[model samples]
Target chain A: MTAPDPSPAHPVTGLDDVVHQRVRLGILTITHEARRVEFGYLRTQLQLTAGNLSQHVTVLETAGLVEVEKGYEGKRGRTWITLTAAGDQALAEEIGRLKQLIARVETTSTPEER
Target chain B: MTTDSVPAGADPRRLLSDVRALAHRVRLDQRLTWVALLVLAVATFVAIPFDYVGMDVRCVNGGSECQFSRDGVLYYWPAALLIAYTAIAFCYVRAARARGLGARVLPYALTGAALAVVFTTVWLLARVYLADPPTEPFPGWVMVLDRLVAPAGTIGVALLVLARLERNVALLVFTLGYLAVVLVPIDFGWTIHSSVRAEFIPQQVINGVVLLLGAAGFAIARRRQR
Candidate 1:
């Protein structure tokens, strides 16, 4: 199954999108927990394929939200992923921003629906 | 920190992680404080055999006192070594668990004052007032002991403060109290006095040796505390 691409009309901010966006956030969150994780493990976790995950990972790598190191184990190419320090910072700031957004929306909404 | 692939500007995370690492370092330091003390202690016991021959200075009051026959020697210099050993021990312990800054200061001053007072009191009694009693005016190589007195007291207090770990403070206190049994008086006091080094060695060396043992005992105690 193919995942839908983000809508073209709404472009994501690197800090807001790379680390704050749900999928990239999941990748960073997972990598932050691991000292170093393989690309396959990340793909399996986000229910993403090599190509789709690669696109998101490229965007994150460009933003310095994660670090990807490539090496080979025997004949197979191995790509490892880990959260960069910037990624950890971006995630924390994004998390704070998310909580604030949630709080603001909650305050404006009716209590019974929430 | 890894040399390569470390990203910049993670100050908040970096600070938090560094803080945890610092706390762990402090714990490891506290765990190892005893080792320095042990080395000093072993040096103390091992120094017992090098007692210098005493020069019996006849006092004005009617008693014979003991002192180092030679002016400068290994026994004379041991106090400085002991003091340095002690300072290192206290500093290590403090670095590990930074407690009682004021108490540490107070004892240091008191030890200095005590050394002066003890020296003067013993000197006056032996030299001017008493009849022909053998005694010396000061421990030999007084100039050599320029900074060691503080370390001696520091090691002593370090041992006392950490004595609960070994449960042998009672034995230590008892043994030092028995110094009168051998009675080899050096350059300072009346018929009854235990020279720091004793009749065989300079008193300064004895001070270092005793504190060295205390430091060793401290190591064992601190280890046990963990």
Candidate 2:
């Protein structure tokens, strides 16, 4: 009989490819907190150029993580973004994995590093 | 297509910290509350002249004596409250649109208006059934009820609802402070002994001052956050 490897799996393995990127994760988090955030607001908050934010948002939109609605507030066109249920769950899971990763790092550090 | 995996080079601790900081900034950008509080404070002050000038005296004991009361507030308060609620809603809508953020303010405004109407109806009914030209003081409980239904108390209750809608701890704290001022019996001792009349100033003035202070505090905090 052979014994399987006893080492724990890395928390990074649980991170979602669609959500792990820093900018996309920020978009998810802001939309989640604000419920429905405007595209301009997200761009400003993330400090990303319009094109950069649009690209990231497009990626998230295609992944079904966020929904974008384009409408006019008075005479100006505005776009609003909202997180989907799956997106919310993904964010929660990502945060949980990040916490596990942080804890793992702390515990594995040597006594002098502590 | 999915985005790339968490950048292998990125630090998880810094990423989490950034997410938390962004959330905190969003939470602090409560742009509409100060406007709402300021409108309510102004409404409270606007009622003073009506209260001071609109006096009603009813003769008792076959016209040998009379009782005085401020009847104008009874008429003015309800309408003023409705207008204030509407203005609050309008300010929230405009600010949300301008800032490109969505806030659940309609419910707060509607709840405030509904509460004002309910309190007004209760006060009117109480006057009709229990205390119209009463020969004696109202019971202790009735007095307490009177305080709760007053304009200042109604505003306090409404602001509590606003605090919940905005998810603002500071606003909640301010609401409690305002409610304490309204609920606790504190006399400012403003008495005018004039030939026109002698009476203690209305307590709504104190409530108004508290609301103004809350508005100023929120404004300052908001500027600092910005």
Candidate 3:
């Protein structure tokens, strides 16, 4: 009997495109923990330039995974980010998939590869 | 438009670890517990004057003997605690906003206030109802309740709720230490020998000192974390 290919059913195939990117994932994780986060704080925490962080945030915002609010704190304009219900579920699912992928790799690795 | 596939050579283990680390950092950074401790410490110290002013001589056992009671503390403690809880809630809100994070402090504030109210009511009822039988010993459970409802005890119990809300192990440890200070009897083995009695209440002073120390420790740790 021939072994069937497991690629189609692998955990990697289950990852969410919008949630799995490293920067976007970092943003989601931080926002989920904080409940709400400032754009500037997110940029500083993720070590991304303002423009770069803004672009990633835009993508997440467009994907309905995060919500953005523009307002003024004192006289300065500020933007705040918060995760919606879908965003929360997405982050949770993404983490679950990552864990499964890690477990699969651990179980399949040879002693020499380890 | 889905970018669902993992990038070539991306390590799942490393990604998961990074996410965990970031979440931990955010949790630690968002805590403003030191402010609450400091506010409570100041409130404790401020109550000393009220305790002194409230002291009165009361006759007991059919007027055979008399003793001093700090009646002012009965009225002042609950009010002080209410104000402290409000201040703590306000501070947490302001600090969280400044840091661009959401704070879950309303429950802690409300719980502390409710505990204060309940303890004060129990204490008042005990004073009114239990005072008549001066010669009779209080029941074991009443004695336990009395200790637990003391001003220091109330604060220590409230800190347990604060620790849980913050999800902070250090705060939990501090709460336990504060409770020990409240429950364990200690003697300094020295008293003022002056002809005039000192206005300071020793227990309140000691409780205030412990709170201030805890606040300082938390502040230092937070600074180091940054």
Encode model 1's per-residue lDDT on A1-114: one tens digit a residue: 999987533111223644544456656665654435578766765567788788888989999888888988669787887778888888777655555554545565797866
Q: Give DockQ per model, in order.
A: 0.03, 0.42, 0.41
Off by over 4 Å in 3: A1-9, A110-114, B1-9, B60-64, B67-70, B139-141, B186-200
- lDDT value, candidate 3, whole model: 0.82
Report chain A TM-scores, every model: 0.78, 0.92, 0.90
Model 3, residue A42: displacement in angstroms? 0.4
In terms of docking quality, model 1 is incorrect
TM-score of each: 0.30, 0.81, 0.85
lDDT values of the candidates?
A: 0.48, 0.80, 0.82
Pairs clashing within candidate 3: A17-B3, A17-B4
Candidate 2 lDDT score at position A84: 95
Candidate 3 lDDT, B3-100, residue by residue in tens:
23347337888889989988888888778889999999999999888887777766679756655555777889899999999999999878888887
For residues B81-193, could you state the per-residue lDDT of candidate 2 as single tens digits?
99999998888776766677766688888888887898788877866786546788778777766778887788888888888877788899988878877776454565454
Cand. 2 TM to true fold: 0.81
Which regions of candidate 1 deviate over 4 angstroms?
A1-15, A111-114, B1-226
Task: Show the lowest summed lDDT stretch of 10 residues, model 1 chain A.
Answer: A8-17
Report the Cα lDDT for residue A35, model 1.
38
